[model samples]
Target: MHGRQLCVCVCAAWFLAANGEDVTCLSEYYMGREGFRSVPLSPLVYTPIAHRPDWYWKKIFQMRGIDPESVKSGYTEAWLAFLFVEAQEAMTVCSIEGGRYWDCILDVRKVYDLAQGSARSTFAGRLAAVFGITLAAPDPLPGHLRLSLCAPARCTESQVVQEIFPLAVDMLMGERPQQMLGNASFRDVVVAHEVAGWHDFDIDFAIVGVNRCGTTSLRKNMELHPDVVIKGDEEETILSYELANRLLPLKAQVEEYNAQVQERITAKFKATGHRPHIVGIGNPLLFQSALVRQKLALMPQLKLVLAVCEPVGRMEKIFMMEKYCHDDLPAAQKRLVAWPYRDGSEVCFPSTSALLTERHGQLKLFWDQRIATAQHLAALAELFPSRLFVLHQTELRDTPSNIFNELAAFVGLRPFPEKIVFRRYNSVGGHRTDLCFNASLVRSLQRLLEREYVMQESILQAFRGIRIAARSTRCDLVDKVDTTYCPNMAC
Candidate 1:
């Protein structure tokens, strides 16, 4: 009786534990892990397609010897049909049993190698990095017999497929073809080609980040110099995350998007009356996202200028200024936010944390997968070398003269103009934050920020170093425009 009672207790405990957790797998943890491995999450989600059926892929072993049913379930119609035809052709060239396997392996390796350096590398690397495991094909099975599906585990087969789906596809696709992968720019394709061969790059520079950094300030200042043509913004992100989701092994969507963006910028300069010598795109958010690094690897000629601010202060600025999150909140709930910067107006809070994890319709899941500051910054720096230029709020206010001069030179521009204009907005520090959150809630946030940034000396140091470097290198001639009121709704 005691034995049965103890067993019951054990079963109950297991049930309770299972019931206590969330359903979806942890994504942010994977993201942080990917950063450490110098890979981003996008690429791992897709892989190249191959020529033959069960030719060289390890996943073929997991499924019984390639049956029609197995092939049908493994890939989409276009990709699978193409593979089937290719397999038939490859078999004719070298029987599946003979030298064909070695040929297949060699071919797949080339494609994999090429993608390893481009955005795809970071994408696939991200998964490998997060799981803290390397992706290696299982050794080929013995000649006659095939691995069978016996009693299966409780997990669904789909879960298992998602895991090895990428590698399986790559084995089917042979070498990296000449055609551009989907819409990937020529610049990015060139980078991938170079990386595949493991060669040095002559890339001019990189913008490196997406949006909201001092990149705007840097770009504006650089624009004044006769030598520079500041490139406008484009959806470079579509190339990284969206295109990575497809089944076409030859198509790299993210690269295509960036290529188009770059071309447009280049064309804009070519069409103009007086084309500038130095050309660049200032999309600050790109630095925060993995896509920028991938794009940078391709356009080696493009120099990089990254403007960084204190993470805690930046987050605060984002939250108080209302960058992107305002769209999600209801107008009634929005009105609750009182902006001290403007009279009787509402401000936006940038963090989506409240929506993703909050008790209301939004803000709940937002905090659930909030990316860490150190992780975000490190990911960008890892992708691009010394091209990044950092700027800080404190540094700008403290040593404006020296910092401005250094910044100008870093971007290969002229000296700073002694007098400059700055657009002034109401100081947030003095604003009454009472309507923002209750004291207890504010305390909780403070603790969160302190835990996230204050303890991270490395990130702080990187920020400081970038700022000092920019100041020491460039010349600043930005005239602070009039008090440019941040649109209340936009903030």
Candidate 2:
């Protein structure tokens, strides 16, 4: 009866010591089973009993029939010995849990104090000298002793390793720290670091431009490539615009923006079964020089694709689209009029006659920046050098296969599918023939924009020379339209 009573008492004490508040630890035990059952010790509850030598002695004798006096006479030395053994066991478990092979001097003295002076300089030093881990004291807590175990540099490459290393070290030092394996806060830190690395590499290119050009069509076709992942809608304008405007600190905004982008790209790659080689954004408003500079500063390796059309045609399309809104779409007209312009002029969609007559100044100001498409592309080419790619809007419309093939090569993609079809998207509709003005007014407007026309011709010649040199042999897929349409019409 006494032996059975003693066995129950030992089991109960061992159970409590092994698991402080965890109910799951008790699930493995069979109530009426014979002999001893193995109950894995919880690292959180198992602190080395250095301060309570008498209790340690009793538990040791009860569990393993080892007399404390026979093992060692000095209490401090025995305690250090016990801690050394526990550290070894903890490190072994950590290694099994994905820690790399560490090779450093184990400095337990940095973590724990001994009455016999530094543990590194004593018998503890001799015992730990043969191991690969170095134990050091972490930042001291006010009411607790904190220890950190560091392995070789290569061991911490994994996010799991980064999280588990600290917890395992604390456990080895008998700190009884909380488990952080699946904790959200800990996981966020790991993810943030991973996202930072991801951002450094993923945004390989951008299609920044003049708004009315064929950016939408180019982006849509680019998305069809297996190795490309361009956002389906318009580019993420707020990212570049707000950052360039300095509404917030640059670093913080960049991190926040890239984190959102990274999530999307990750999900896309997971579903597509092929990792995207180049992720791009197509935001026409990013053509603003200030925004372009800001983007370059953020990603110096960014490849730029500038798509430009005849300035007058683009401006006319923009004006006609506005007119359609004002005359036919009342709700859209209300919204359009309320939209803010950088020049502080009231937004208006005047009749074509009024636009060519009274409101010409506002129209000129609105299209002036865009009309100088050659200057913008030249400036960007000078700034970005080989990283810049200029695409003619006409080619995008007439010979899309050739343009897309060239674009695919420029942005580092395998040649797109041979049977690829490029369809015009987001083309402006509802343009009225009555929007055309008198031929005298058209000549006057052409003379006003003559410099832009010359620059546009120069850019077309430059791109043509480049294409011819590259030996791009694809046949033009669509018939060429009269180039004189824009110059002849009062667009």
Best of the candidates, TM-score: 2
Local accuracy of candidate 2 as per-residue lDDT tens digits, 1-491? 25764464356447655766332222222221121111112111123345433544465445556556654533233343343334344444434443322212223332333212342233333323323223233222112322223232233334223333333343232222122222323322322111111124347778888677877777778887888887545576644545332211223445766676667677778997877757788887666554344335345567878787655555566665543224435444333421223233345555555456644475666555645565666555555656777776768766888989888998888898998677776553333323443445445556666676665555556654533111111111112323222211122
TM-score of 1: 0.43
Candidate 2: list runs displaced more than 4 Å: 1-201, 246-252, 323-325, 331-350, 359-364, 367-374, 429-433, 463-491
Candidate 1 residue-wise lDDT, 260-314, digit = tens: 5466457656776545555555555655443334435444455565545444334
Model 1, residue 35: C-alpha shift (Å): 37
Error of 2 at 300 (Å): 3.4
Question: In candidate 1, where is summed lDDT lowest over 10 consecutive residues?
Answer: 191-200
Give the root-mean-square deviation of each candidate in angstroms: 21.6, 20.9
* lDDT against the true structure, each candidate: 0.38, 0.48
Model 2 residue 237 distance off true place after TM-score fit, in angstroms: 2.1
* Candidate 1 local Cα displacement, residue 132, angstroms: 27
The deviation in Å at residue 451 for candidate 1 is 5.5
Q: Any idea what lDDT model 1 has?
A: 0.38
